[model samples]
Target: MTMNALTASAAALFFNHDGEVLIVNPTYKDHWNLPGGAVDIEQGENPYDAAVREVREELGITPPIGRLLVHAWLTVPGRGAQVLYVFDGGVLDHDTQAAITLQASELSEYRFCPPHGMEDGLIPPHLAGVWQQALIAHAEDRITYVPVRL
Candidate 1:
């Protein structure tokens, strides 16, 4: 029997009082992404821990991470399969918002983007849909699953 390798990544959905989602521009990639990164499965890191760790590493904050919002199955032609988790980072209060410091090497900038502006903020454009679903799942106090191909 043959086994296929699958990787996973975790992200968080942070919002402001104005209902804008937080997004970051990565220095290593052209597209803007949420404040999370690949799950270090090799190092025994789970998705949840990875989310928390990534947020701290990327944004320099340790805000309480809430429940899972979305679980997405993604298939990339060359990269194989990946599972993505989006967790509710909750709304950032003024104090937390003011403390954000982007990782100089990993991120170029971070911004709060309103829902209508996500299409322009996210790369591939379709990612905006996943983020929107995450917002809906958060608001409804539920979880969602989405399939994506890249």
Candidate 2:
């Protein structure tokens, strides 16, 4: 890939039955984002495997993977350009589970919250308004299953 070509990455938006958003507070950054990470090209890794692995690693819950919701260009300051691939995650038996806690080294917290609870004031400045937009896109039926790029 060219230097300017943003590396592709995958993320899981693990939504509860009530539609609550699962946000991960990461150890690497002050801002919380969905569970996901870079695609390990060295292992010949693809985006779907990376997404599932990230969710399992961060939350310790591995639900049946679901559809694609949104795809966009996400750039973390100083982390370089990244093409973000977000998928809709499905869960079962919500009440039986304990809240997923952040892994100490890479995560600080994880929680299910009202979609509106994610806002400018509380959200990381870089990702401030994204959750709302994602919800809006979902409500408007703009979010749909996207085939992973080959």
Candidate 3:
């Protein structure tokens, strides 16, 4: 029997008092995304830990990461399959927001956007839908599963 390997990633969803979600513009990608990266599964890193680590590496702050919000199973056509975990990063106070130090090599900027504005920044467009669902799941204190194909 043969085994198939699927990639995994974890992201942290942060928001402001105004209910705006935080999104980052990556230097390598044309569209914006949440703070996160691929899970280091080969190194024994889990989704939760990857979310925490990615946040620290990207934002330069160790904010409290809360409950899981969404688990997306995505198929990227020729790129194979991937599982994405989105976790609640809680609200970022002004002080914490001011302390952000982006990894210039990987990120260009970060901004807080209203839920309705996510579609304007996210790539593939469907990501905005995933994030919107995540926001809903966050509010309801539940988790959601989204399947996306591209």
Best by TM-score: 3
lDDT of 3 by residue, 20-39 (tens): 99999999888899999999
Cα lDDT tens digits for candidate 1, 52-99: 999999999999999999999877676578899999999999999999
lDDT of each: 0.89, 0.67, 0.90
Model 3 residue runs over 4 Å out of place are 1-5
- Model 2, C-alpha of 129: deviation from truth (Å): 4.9
TM-score of every candidate relative to the true structure: 0.92, 0.75, 0.93
Model 2, TM vs. native: 0.75
- lDDT string for model 2 (93-117, tens) is 5552474645677888777777777
Model 1 CA lDDT for position 131: 83
Candidate 2 residue spans exceeding 4 A from truth:
1-5, 75-80, 99-101, 128-130, 140-150
- Give the clashing pairs for model 2: 27-106
- Candidate RMSDs in Å, in order, are 2.7, 4.9, 2.7
Q: lDDT score of model 2?
A: 0.67
